[model samples]
Target chain A: MSLASRELPSVAATMAPPRSPADTPAGAISGPSWLNNLRAMLAKELLLEWRNLSRLGSVALFGAVTLVLFSFVAPPQAGARRMATAGFLVLALLLSSTLSLSESFRKETHHRALTGLLLVPVAPSAIFIAKAFANFFQLVLLAPVLIPVALVLFSVDLTATSGVSYPLLQLLAVWALASAGLAAPGTLYAAMTSDLRGRDVVLPLLFFPLVVPVLLAAVKATALVLSGDAMGQLGSWNLLLLIFAVVHGTLGTVLFGYAVEES
Target chain B: MRGKFQWEHAVLLLALVLLTVGTYIGLAVAPPERHMGDVQRIMYVHVPTAWIAMLSLTVAFVAAIGSLWSGKHKWDAAVVGSTETGVVLTGLLLSQGMIWARATWGVWWDWDVRLTTSLVMFILFAGVLALRASVDSAERRASWSAVAIIVAYADVPLVYFCVRWWRSLHQVQSTPETVDAAMMLPLRINAFGMLFLATWFIVRRARLELAQRQVEETTLPERRSVEEVQHA
Candidate 1:
């Protein structure tokens, strides 16, 4: 057989060349699954926050320090002490919320990973809801740390009042409602302002003003609950919170899409 | 020549003249409250300021939706201009509110839900304007501020509802469902008047800024941007 014929003899036996398209992964694990994607995004955000150990530490420390500072400003009387306690807790919530606003989405933006997160199929509102939940979690953890100091220093009445539930429940509700108020707009604005030069300064400028309604409602509601004032007023405060939640929640849901697009 | 000054400019000047007269009328022509005398003069500024703030936000909300859908720079300009004006008017209203509260409530400030929420609305827009100012890229600034406009617009109802939901020192004066004829006339007049003034101001500012930006872009050397584009 000639050299060319010898080389060609295997043509009948050999397989055709594999096409590039066929070789490509047919069912390869490209990215996370639906549930896993959401969880991973949320978990990644939380982990990034945790790694910044100093931010949370400062927030917790500030709440405690502020509680102690406000205690000194409180008078010895029962009503005054209660008022001071309520004021201090509300202020603590505001400060933490402010901190949350400034730092809420910093990790994602800093890592330049937000674009990747956005590429995921998860909804934008979920990101907002998850961030808000994270903020609420931080506040919940910080509250207990500050509560004992608040009680000890300010003599806040933590004992169950006649009509009001345990002081803890009332305070918790206040924090949750206020947290939602602060976080909704805070997250939205942070997302919007993340690309700005001075994001820290920009964040609070947008945050504190929009939080006025929630702060007022929270302060009054917390004050009423703490004072064991007319139970009727508590009902009103709840209604106020419901309004804020609905308005801001709807707003967040609607605008978050645009924000994510802008981001 | 683009008619040197457009009809809109003339209309704006006329509106300003009318607004000055309205201020005088509200402060001097209107009867003083029997209980809350001379200091009631503050209402002229307070009422007008509040009216303008809400009007500005309404414009912003419309402009936001417009820009988001149309992608026209004019709508974005409207959003920026109105938001800036809204924030300024809200701030003025807040300061006026503080003065009113000091006179009536015997305190300079109170944690009233309505007042606080209004302040929040002011801050929301302030942040918005800051967000707009801080960015050099027009597209990013417009798109981002548009997001802010929608977010802030959503808070309007929350601010409005705050007065009614919580026991607040600030009273809920007017609502579509609840307005009385006695208060409605002046309130309607003031509301419409303020709307006109806000639109006028927004258009005027937007035109000037847009023109300035156009001039700046045209004047920049082409080679610099072309080189930057190539490097990118």
Candidate 2:
């Protein structure tokens, strides 16, 4: 009874703010408008993320730690070291993405909170967009912390820009695109596997392979950003990253209803 | 969908006979290539398997779309069948490519375009199988697997393009002009043979999935009715 009551207020409160259910008679209103529902859900997602800022901190630390390990694995030679730096940094982002993606849905299992989200009758597309957008922004946030950590560890200075225009901005663009890539599919797969027993293993098994193009494109684009873009080929690689994100994001919106409705 | 004597048997027999003849002719009758010599014979089996692997996944992709739209058992079964067949052939294709690579490149593997794409494709589809294995609810299993298959299939073209951009050490694609006139017969024969063999495997797999589903329904009569109503 207590859990049911708690789940109802936040959902119902969004519908009618001034009047409680007791004051507003049965025929007083229909359910919340679709726009209201989406806004409420998005607000709820961001609010939850805001509440767990500490978790974000830990996840950043995790990404930083992975960066340190990647630096160790790179060869001692200077030329190869620069090449490996971009790949490893994006790889760290990809790996850290799995952590928070899984956690985002795992929280919904508490008192079956996701079931409440569904029972709130939120549109599945709205649900997916909210979840995917939150996850995407989370990945983007990691970039600020991780990029500096990578620069310090790899000892690459931005001021040494040769044939490169706006190195920092280019890196940010690639990071945003890569995060979009991971966020779409990762949120979808995490939604499916989060209800399973071996989710930790299952999520990565599905996610990592699906994002190979993202990893390759992002790594390549990042490499060009770090080094000089002699051939002027960075735009195409960044476009590839954008393509993956857009394709999966659209697909996920269409399919998440099916993946989530039953569970 | 079930009968005493199925079309799969005919396909199986035809595939067997064609494969035997094609292998014999490829081994003894076809003239050896001037460059790779006898080692090039592997292309007969290798190219056919690669073609059929793509076909299998395409079949899976179409079936995935079908399953999602119709929510039918047969579509789900085809998703399982063709995806499993695709994975098996991709594994075989990888090994065959490795043998060919060792003979030519003098290394077990290289980060060439097709080679890396094929390796990633193999892991990608195989991951679909692994995803399927972990889902316990039959309904969720069907939909989720279809979803995964579609999502995975979308990446194939993307992987091809990205890998091409990254690097291309693999040789140029063989066209009719490039391939020797004498080599065409075995290649055609093996390609058809492999196609039939893949069809037979898909039908057999779909039948097995249906049979298992039948056993489940019989065991859980109450749930079967519930599922029927759910579908209805």
Candidate 3:
């Protein structure tokens, strides 16, 4: 992530003295480099996210609720239920992600704490990375709660699925990939919309269509894990998810400065 | 200078003439497809509209980068104009596709890969516009909307591939060589005509956007009463 410092120039970069150490992160000056700052910021983010277990509880509950509601929408026919279980599980995660992401930036806004952090000379890239990782971890944590509930509610037995040698492991990997993909771009949009009016509507509006690739790939991969991957197509779908995560992760890191510089 | 004959008028006239001629030839001159019959004629307008919409989005992506890189109002205006044009053209393209689908496929909608991606593309750009609408400050609006457009533009390829991989019922893309000789003229003419029309719309829309910014920046406070001013 420190590699981003060379190419990054924000409102702060223009206003700060050129002789300052922030611009040149090669550690020539004794000041903290981008990586150190990123570490500190990431630690701060994890600490905050860790302190909010109750919040995660509510979000998990929301996911479970969404899972239940989705089950009701499908007919009781065994074949159709089995076919749709993967979609239901992923959609629950997708919906619950909005709940968690929208709140991730709220803590930063109180008392203009975000402005205070920016004043402390934290690189926006660091802040973005920290927030994205924290969000990613939070969503991953949801897998423990939501996946089991989904399996039970949908009457799915991963062990009985075909093609894949390790269905449970594959499903976990799919969840993590989807979470990472959602977290990167989700963090960026969440930051933009956090303080805006009608943010609830705006965040999902901007996010859902943009992350269609993630949703599609995750659902397909999960379905394959749950049902069968006779054509050995699971690897390709997982690759799509990884690509989505990487592209947006890099983009969000580079663009965060512009989005949050004014604040 | 206020009422001068401008280049936009010339572009607009050319677009209209080309569109009229192209539509006529597309409807009357081009031979119907062997299977779909005259229903294939919808492709004449639909294909051009799709091409122009995609082009407009590419322009929007470029302008988005320029806006973020330079922090210039002109770039922001271009972003607005191009994205708006893209959205409108995509809407028209979808409608035309639906009409063609209804005639041939016996349904108005299906989960075809290209169709899904196009719909998602439409929504993504529309979301950018929605974000722009909600922001009150012009600078923040410009920056945020540019960010949104960049993100959305980057997602386009992924969206297309993901949808395609998930389920693909749509036909493969058609090239000029695959098309009949008689269909080529109308397609080429209409493609150029749509491109020109999109340019005309983008230019005019950008001008209006820049004007709006000027109005916002130049609005002065109400004139104070003479007595109150003298006392101060």
Candidate 4:
């Protein structure tokens, strides 16, 4: 047997027992019960974030600062200014999401928690799915504050036939969909780079290019919502976003097992 | 070893001959276009470079799948070789495209579908190479890069479709029907020349990767023992 496989039992012995009975097989958890492991992992991630609100706060602060700075730098012209604001909003979210993803993976590396997780009998894909969901949640949490600030600063006309509530709901949908699209590849790339030094530099270089489609669709959709597209052009962009989310999410889950096993 | 050297030399000689003839045909034999005159000649190089760029990446994608399926060092070498070649060709394609655009479109750059998709492809593969460089272990690097290439390749069609649907200022994509028969000759010649050159480069680079891996294996035998002991 390979050294890694030989060492697995000892590592498993050192790790805590599975929290749920379903996760623990009669003897040694032979094959992971994916759904149960996913639930347990996702809970652990959420609980960890709840315990440490500072990290989420910092990410939100960074996004807010970016939006404010963008609003100032953008030309005060009416038409161009609104379009630029949509672009910048996507940019800010992209940057903040990159930071949060790297940080989330960094936490595991910092506390050596990854080793413990790796030791668990659950499939590595479970860890990936859980981390992706957690990152998506964190990005969603930023929407309430970030969206309002963006709308106000960019002078987005929300008083359409349906009023502010409709646009707000549209924007939130964009955020959630974009967040899923971003987080899948973001979490996977974070795990890939977690062991490397200078991962801060490496992650964005790897990430931004891969996620360009997501950024483009999100920005376009957001612009349409801001301008109030009456012709239903937004549907195509939303479809693109959905395709991006599904493609990356599925790819990340399937590939994460291979990526995380590297160390 | 002797056979390999003979094939390499033969391929090199053939590539040189084809390239010289292709350049002559492209620059001299082919009549200038009605719209742009001699500046349109750049298409001979630009189109082939773009074609080969996509071709090389397609090769890399296949090699990535091969590496994942067979877990062979040779497949990883093929991945590296084709990917690196794709990057160089992509860079060439971009510059030639800019030159062609400046003469024809009156702008050095346009956010057109093809240009945007090609740029994204270049960045994506370049990131794969960068990722390959950062990792320490051969096995890890190979496997991770294989996975990366597959993921990046998945985006190729998506990027193409997205950009195409979003905006297109560039000409409608050229096909045999659009290209003049006389103009098609040089384009075909240059394309074959490029294909031969790309093949030689990929073969040579793959061999180099294999040789380097061999040397690394011999020189770093102790690292394995150390890892084994650590795991133990």
Off by over 4 Å in 1: A1-36, A46-55, A76-78, A120-123, B1-3, B16-49, B91-118, B163-196, B215-232
Best by TM-score: 2
- Model 2 residue A47 lDDT? 72
> Where does model 3 exceed 4 Å of error?
A1-32, B168-177, B220-232
Report the C-alpha lDDT of model 2 over A1-263, residue by residue, as the tens digit: 23333454465446323334544322221344545556666887787677777888899999999999988888888778877889889989998999999987877665566665666566778778988999998999999999999998888888795888889998999999999999999999999998787888889999998999999899999988999899889999989999999999999988998888763
- Listed in order, each prediction's TM-score against the native is 0.77, 0.91, 0.90, 0.90
Best by DockQ: 3
Give the DockQ (2 decimals) of all models. 0.57, 0.68, 0.70, 0.65
Clashing pairs in model 2?
A: none
- By DockQ rank, best first, the candidates go 3, 2, 4, 1
Q: What is the interface RMSD of each candidate, in Å?
A: 2.3, 1.2, 1.1, 1.4
CAPRI verdict on model 3? medium
- Regions more than 4 Å wrong, model 4: A1-32, A160-165, B1-6, B168-177, B222-232
Once fitted onto the true fold, the runs of candidate 2 whose alpha carbons sit more than 4 angstroms away are A1-33, B1-3, B168-177, B221-232
**Prediction 1: B-chain TM-score:** 0.79
